[model samples]
Target: MATVPFPFSPVSCAFSRQTGIRRSPLVLALLSSSALLFPVQVHAQQANAGAEATELTEIVVEGATDSASGPDKSIVAGRTLAGSKTDTAVEDISASVSVITQAEMERRGTQNLDEVLAYTSSVSADEYGSDDRYDWVRIRGFYQTSTGSYLDGLPMRISGFTGSRVEPYGLQRVEVLKGSTSTLFGLNAPGGLINSISKRPQAVKHGEVYTTLGDEHVEFGTDFGGPIDDQGIWSYRITSKWQDGNNGADHTEDDRFYIAPALTWAPTDATSLTLLPSYNKRDGNTAHGIPYGSGIDPKTYLGEPEFEAMDTIEKNIGYAFSHDFGNGLQFRQNARYTDLDLTYESVYGATADPSVSRSAWAVYGNSRRFVIDNQLQYDVSFGRFDSRSLAGMDFSYNDTDEHRVFGSASGINIYNPVYCGLSCLTLPAGYDWNQQETARGFYLQEELTFDDRWILTLGGRFDSVTTESAFPDSGLSYKADDEAFTKRIGLTYKVTDGLSVYGNYSESFQPISADRTSLVGTPKPQEGTQYEVGLKYRPANYDALFTLALFDLTQTNVPYNISTTTQSQIGETNVKGVELEGKFALTDQFNLTVAYSYWDAEIVEDGITGNQGNKPQLIPQQMASIWADYTLPGEGIFGDLTLGLGVRYTGASFADNENTLKIKPHTLVDAAVNYQIRDNVALAVNATNLFDTEYLSYVSIYDNTAFYGDGRAVRATLKYTW
Candidate 1:
């Protein structure tokens, strides 16, 4: 059987079948935006006749390869460039890295970043349960929210109430680089960073239209791309999604709309320029937390539903340009500018009081950011040694304006609900706070290879960061400035074509949170170091990669105390762990992925006696997962059927720094089935938490709230491609 690329995708708005809800305002806006792009596409098609005709073969980067399959190919492949910012095979990179390809995300029906990385090794996602506001994830026992998240290798600056929410459909792949990355990138966490690669235009035309139906929501999406000119020098891609539905929790809505348009222009074989633009709008309510002693159910909604909503609108525009000189020398530049707006208002559970009365909180914010990076890379060989050197500099600027109000709101019963008008609540007047942060960095790296076996990498960076905060009402201001130099070294020895052993030593520095509330008078930045060793195996004849890694990391100068009277930084943390991961395509019809991790994370030193020597909250000691998929032979009338099964296990952990409250461990099961109706059409059904096991996703000490993980739910998808 021969498979063709999916056809021109049409934007869709899939409302709930049960509720018959209409399209959201956000969707309407996206549809209007789509209307504007179609004209340009039409013009491109018409201009192809007048343009000079030429034949240009597709240029494949050294380590970037496309298998026989289309854009949505199988995940078990052999090439990736995320590890080194250069075209390099994953097995050759010394760091511990994981690549989640688009094919895997589509096969698993991943709707968000959290879901896409759920089964990945050394990653913990959805720490706050099933919230749609952010993709909260931890890497190697450290938070990645503020320090370790990037888009296309550039750090995404998020301050106060502003965040960047990416649409999964617009992504080509997600790369997780474990261990300190300050050596190549700027300041970041000791655990590592996640880089998301955007979908770019392809010389070959492809498109898909799909709709997903779930327990409480429906979503429609499309992806299409092809050459815009007869000479194939110009290509374009457009992707869009619209969804409207409720979450499993009562009165919580998950509505969103997204669109991304990309264009590529290759005037010559050695040079190319691409423009990427995206827009996203989200209108959803925050997931509430329940008190431990409260009789309220985890799925119950205690807030005034009609008066609660967290809405956000964001836009991003960027361009990437690269040109190759002679003799393996290249120049590349990538830049993006973003604007974000958020409006959030909610009444959440405050106490265990059965009456469920609590204070209402509201925040309205606007933010703008700009980031750009440029690099020069050269590949050279002398005798038996090969050297690849890279030099780059990057800068970023961010500004945020926020208004917040906290006031009392009338409480309602969980079992019996009553509508309380917004008039019944009290709100503070005026916009009260503002913040801004700026950062710049310069870096250089060199990779040297000996014979065909030994590889050595050395890199260093210098960074400077500044943050400012103001309170309009109090007439107070705060400022912090930091500068640091970091370095990293790694060596890899290839034992054979299929196996390699590698080791690395790296360092990291993290400045205090830019938010005025946490800036403590130019305090010393938190510093960390790590030593890691790993083995990677890629069977020559099989489409599989297996990895094993062990590492020890320590971070010091943590903020030990923060009070109005005094602020001090005297704390330390240590994390030691081992991880194993494997993904394989045993045969044409069978695929499997397995991951396991064990971590010992503890507070080595702290000002608070009760917290010292305790395990960090929410840092589980053990995690493991396995997924297997099998495709059944196609019979007479039926096309083909693929069934997938997965299991995930999480060990117990402390709910607070004091380690008094213990969260019990739990196991979950997930299953999926895909039935191909025809060569270009298919239906898929996926379910998570199959047994409906209820477990705590997060336990907040300050809020005294417990949030539960997602319950059992099913999603069915119908897709058509050409």
Candidate 2:
């Protein structure tokens, strides 16, 4: 549909020098970092190495005393900014929050965002099976694909099929905040939201280069950053990656190219500004499914190789600025603008037959978005009482244009299919439309503490949202304007030196963005309410944190898709769940994590649909996972080895809202092994679904289609760092 040229030529030159062959722009961009950035020199051992090591140790000790560990680099993060726009201890937040650090992601060898969150509590990843197009995730029985994603505290909200994708390599840490959060974030889902912290400039110089090889996959990447001058007033960081591979399906393609360059200007410690800009391109195919009980190979390709395609392009520029006025008061602002385009086409079986009945479809969409948030915080103390007050405002705007087409494809026998190419497929124009939305919110919050043992928090926000949609072919247009106010209150009491109990009540509001005529009539904004209580404990003798939480969350005026072009907002749902999560560093070389979740979710009210008291589709009521990593003492040969293991369990779920079909439960195992080849070189191998388990990841009774879970996957990586 739409195209943009590569911004740099060094990427192509460097790639050609390494591979000895010319390739697409994607491959060229992957290799360009070395040419643009200064190269690192490796030194050999010298006779005075022992003396140099002693001197280095002293420097490290001095640096450690001057600065504390940041949450992005620690395995067990203790502080987070997602809960309150300010840095606060996780145990005192009065709500459930989970953080996945960069070190943890490396240990697990996560390849995508879904895998990065596979072991999180109250999260369901890969709900639609092995799809390379998007990361399908749900939190607490509620889908969050359209509204629950954020980057650096700014919303990455999506409309229709125009969504943004994140590159895990460019992230420092991922934080999950559970329950309603509209009081501070403006608009979101009731279940939760995900915030990804971007990798920024570091005071210390660091650089790494890595290559990975796996089944039908090859990749190369590099990340490096440091001070730009001797005074250290300016610093810069750059990250890039390129991959060419395929998913579990046969005759499919999965290729991507991504790069992010960041710079920070901190003239003084009190004021700082950072600019972040990135570009990403993806080339893949749409997901395909077979009929239930078909006994067909899961990797079978049902679409025409020449006619099937899915490509997306995204570009972004953003900045974060903050300043301290020197008196217990601070000001901060964050903003981002994004442009995204997508082109997708697919052909799949339309009926359960040995000679498949196939249908063809295509969609082309483009979206542009801009979001900004500004905050002011004041901290002061009076006698035995302390207070931290926060006031902020945020604005978000999105514009989207989309076109769809559908047609019929010639039938082919599943047992022995023959290739017909593009001549066998035909598609006609279907729907063409444009939509735009704008939202503005203002919020205020206050946190009070008494005697350093009891804490109270109160927050409220008022939001105004406007949406407009137009169909060009039909000459029809509709507009809606809505306003809402949401509030949150919480209290926490310290029971012991390292234990605390907390309770909270919060609310959320979301405006509908679909066509009014296609819907029942005028649709009202969805509202959500939640009541939660939780316990948090951090051991005094060990580096560990444990949490237990129970919550009751409800959402009214929920919308459901009646067809590809129509929807209705006549549903109300409720979910009551318990979640337990723990992270422990048992010893100097051992780490363990455990998580479990149980949900009782039901459709409480439905007007148009007669089946009301049923469980929502594709939501597992029970899920659990555990991971452990251990490394040997690095004293001699074979001492630099490390091992990791994990297991995940997902309980059964219904295939549809009517609950007529049940999908069986499944459990999968993952493992990793790593060895330090040299002081600056390492090798690692990781495997997921080690047993090659075969089970259903999703099923849709309405379409009579089923998708199989991913099979065994293995990857080996070699990395060099300085």
TM-score of each: 0.89, 0.89
Candidate 1, 237-265: lDDT as tens digits: 99899998776887888788999899999
Cα lDDT tens digits, model 2, 110-211, are 988888999889998887785555667678777666788899999887776666567888887888899998999977778888898887888878889999
> Which stretches of model 1 miss by more than 4 angstroms?
1-72, 354-357, 514-522, 562-564
Indicate which candidate wins on lDDT: 2
The residue-level lDDT of candidate 1 at 6 comes to 12
Candidate 2 versus truth, CA RMSD in Å, comes to 11.3
After superposition of all CA atoms, the RMSD between model 1 and the true structure is 12.9
Report clashes for each candidate as comma-separated counts. 5, 1
Clashing pairs in 1: 5-722, 6-207, 6-722, 7-207, 7-722
TM-score of 2: 0.89
